[model samples]
Target: MTNFSHRRVKTGSDPRRLADYAALRNELAKLSHPARPDVNWQSVEKRCDALFEQNGVELQSAAWYTLARTHLAGLSGLNEGLSLLETLITHQWDALWPQPVAVRMEILCSLSQRMQQLLRTFSPSDSDYSALNLAEQQLTRLISALQRRELTPLSPLNALLSLIHHSAVRLEKSNSAAAPVVENDPEVVLTSTGISAAPSPETTRSANEVKWIYLVPPEPQLATNPQIPPPAAATLWQPFALGMLAMLVLGSVALWSWSLFQRPDPLQTPLASSLSALPSVLSPMQLETLRQQGPLSDALFTATQQQLTRLSQLPPDWATDYSRQLVKQAQLLWPEKSRQLTQQWQQQVNAAALPADTMNGWHQGMTELQTLADKLNALDEKRGRYLTVSELKSAVFSMMTHFRQTIPVEEQLRLIRQLPDDSPARQQQIEQAGQHLRAQAYALMKEKEKETTAASF
Candidate 1:
């Protein structure tokens, strides 16, 4: 495939261009060690796009490469970055990048490494086999091209070959595996069709009952007709019992007649109270403060951003209003930074044209973030207070429910990425956690959908 950058003939050899490239590279490097990849990646992406529009072929290629790496760096995931990387370098690196062969080798090596990292992030069951195959094809092509250049098998080339072999083996193993992997869900489960509860044992068991062995004596069950057998005890109560039975029959008939005319009340659904629903907005400083609290805070931040990003399909007016509301609230909280943020945001809004999705999910996401903050605050308040076991259990269960509701798969992957890069254990953990979250979310959503459908009737 032809390199898109080769269509332009602009030489980016000027001193100023080189300086800009240096700055751009500096930005790209940050993604590799990003403290706030969610927040920072967008800006880097925008900058690269702008540079690509205004710069020469070499610079544009460089920009495209950087943009691709941003995805590799967690802007998206492996497929996107891999697609971009493959598109950029097919047969035009010399025209696209216009650098030394050594630099070319380095860039390709980095791409291979990133692909390796991305591959490691998936399990056999949930892996993107298509992506692996694509990467394998691309690696083969690149390695062959390098060979045609009469280049010896260097470390980078070897790495590419290694990944290709790994992909083949993986694909083979996946195809040859006879046993289907069933999701282990214990009692309540995500089945092939949907969520379901496993049946109790009693219905399927034999008629013979098993005796219970108890250290403490079990409570004896009462005989239903104990008083009827003892004539002395029964005789005096019989008249009273007959009177009571007559009264009960009359009351039951009257109640049944009343019920025939009464209507059943509709169930009231609980309102989902979120922080975004609050009267106030969170400032950037406050968001930073959230990040400072610890990993859960970081996860909360990450998860909120993710859910908020999904809300990006909102109406432009709604998005604008939501963002401005945030700006106004931040102004109330921190006048200094809010002014700058407001100006920047407005400029962006205007540039994109008003009534467009300007800040999708900011408001709703803030509410979710705020909801988490409130919950954490409540928990914090309990410090030094003696919490009963029941109270502790309720709190734990509530927090877990909120966590699962708030935190998405992305945050877990992000957290995993934050660990040291050289551990097989970390890779396995990421794959497990990611798959579990996805399956759990899918099951719950499907179950909720069924509930909604049933409730409508």
Candidate 2:
């Protein structure tokens, strides 16, 4: 634990004051990580704002940085986070508040990553262009900043920027491919290879086994009645009967195989059908011939992506009908998952047709509680014991207030009200926070007293 109290700032540019600045930065980093049920971003954002205004040169930037990130991670206020970071990097940061160049560089890199996601989810239409432009502009700014730093082409940040740039390029290429400029038609038409593509060894073996079963007649038993000498007419008729039987069997197998191909796909059936009426639309043999596929979520994403890619290529009027049919075909094994996924796809399609930004301006802007909590825990903790006892006290109180305020009052009551009265850890933390606050508080009081005593003498 750090002695986070009683710090003086900018007093003759002292070494200790500099250290306090370092410590304050670390504390802010910890408090702003994405939330658990224990962590609430909106509440923490308020705390950082309060500290940002009151802190000295060294600590102000840290508070600003953390608060910006908190907004980015919160479910609401995605714009607020993006705008703040934009301002932070757009200006010469050191001139504004002595924020280190390295810190600004780090912010720039992180911003580029978020922008890359926007490019990935961009719809292949004009409605998507404005948001993509925002992302592209920011990414361009980041690249410019790195260039200003004279970052090498091989630097890690450069590598990340390259990946981001590629997403945008890929999206643009896809749209271009969809609207080909070529005047000439292709000489060769690409028809479905169908099941005409060569079958696997297993499929070939199964087919051969079935064919041979009918084709090969059982061997004749050695005639115990050979002495009777079978009639010539009976032997001749026996060969003809056997040949006819084999022909009948072969015709029946051929009919069944033809019917299999002609069967209507369940995906093409009307929407009123129950998912559970059949164990699967595929037959036991067909299912057996094919290997099993996917965890439902992975399958849904894959299927949806492929369909959406084609859907995007169509004109909006055509896409409207196509999207409905495409989602129907994408129904997976589970009805519930299928329903939820297709509904979401429909919503996106509807939103895309309008000028509205459907994804809250980006694909992943919303942060759920559990996800936020996990992010909070996984973040790198800043390390260092700095800040004089008084400043440390102010800093500690800010952190304490952060811990105190983020949980809802009802949750707070439930968590603490019925717990054992003896909370050693809680008591110790309070004592520590109070120690920081009071020590700094007394320092000012004592300083005032010294002036009075001097005047009286």
| lDDT of each candidate versus the true structure | 0.51, 0.43
lDDT per residue for candidate 2 within 47-164, as digits (tens), equals 4433333442222443343344424432112223333333343432444343465654554454344434533453335223233333345445645755776753425445544754
- Using lDDT as the measure, the top candidate is 1
RMSD of 2: 44.9
Give me the runs in candidate 2 sitting further than 4 Å from their true place: 1-39, 51-90, 96-100, 103-129, 149-160, 163-457
lDDT of 2 at 171: 55
Candidate achieving the largest TM-score: 1
Alpha-carbon TM-score of each model against the true structure: 0.29, 0.24
Off by over 4 Å in 1: 1-23, 31-39, 56-94, 124-127, 164-168, 175-457
